[model samples]
Target: MGLLDNVKSKLSPAKDKVSHLAQKHEDKIQHGLDRTAHAVDKKTKGKYSDRIQSGTGKAKHAMDRLAHKDDDGGSMSPPPAGGATPPPPAS
Candidate 1:
């Protein structure tokens, strides 16, 4: 096997274990994501509430996909055709 393939083979077991652990802790992760976004909003004095919420939702969705990679790799569905694009990440 090529070097990259060999590396992937070695890492597959670790990846599976991580996915399993993430699935087991999914609820905790979701709660923590919510709490973190809420706290950030509070700290920002609600100035970025909408942005914070949107980002957090995306993150949770990504995590869900990661924890269930057999379905899809942590991807949020594409936004509606007419919907605004998500803002770029903060620098």
Candidate 2:
């Protein structure tokens, strides 16, 4: 396999583990994200309120993806047909 494929293979197990954990503790994780965002917003006295809110929203969206919350039957869906490229994974 190529270097990128090799690296992805090695990380697959860890990714699966993280996905499982995220699914199991989704509520708690979301709550923690909200609490942290609130604390940071308060500490900054609303100077970075917009940015903080945006970041928190992004984070929650990522967590939902990791948990596969959008998937039906708790499994990943197949990629679309017509050779359309899938979106890159979230950073």
Candidate 3:
């Protein structure tokens, strides 16, 4: 295997672990995201409400994808169209 394939193979288990953890704590994660967004919005005095909401929605969608929880609560692969593009990590 090429270096890329080797790297992917090595990382596969870690990725699966992450997916499992994300699924197991899906609801708590969702709640945390919502609560965080609300707190930030409040701190900003609604100045960034739109952006905050958008980001929150994207985060929830991503968590759903990671948990293999689709709209119908059925397992699904990563979204075929946009894919599960995570946002840049916060500094």
List, residue by residue over 1-91, the lDDT tens digit for candidate 3: 8999999999988978988899889889987887788778777877777788778877877777877743456555443444222333343
The parts of candidate 2 lying over 4 Å away from their true place are: 69-91
Taking the tens digit of each residue's C-alpha lDDT, what string does model 2 give over 28-91?
9988887788777777777777787777777776677778844765554443232221222233
Clashes, model 2:
0
Off by over 4 Å in 3: 69-91
**Candidate 1 lDDT, 4-78, residue by residue in tens:** 999999999998998898899998987787778767776787788678767876777666676887765456665
Which residue runs of candidate 1 sit more than 4 Å off their true CA positions? 71-91
RMSD of each: 6.8, 10.7, 8.2
Error of 1 at 45 (Å): 0.8
- The candidates, ranked best first by TM-score, are 2, 3, 1
What ordering of candidates by lDDT runs from best to worst? 3, 1, 2
**Candidate 3 weakest ten by summed lDDT:** 82-91
Candidate that scores best on TM-score: 2
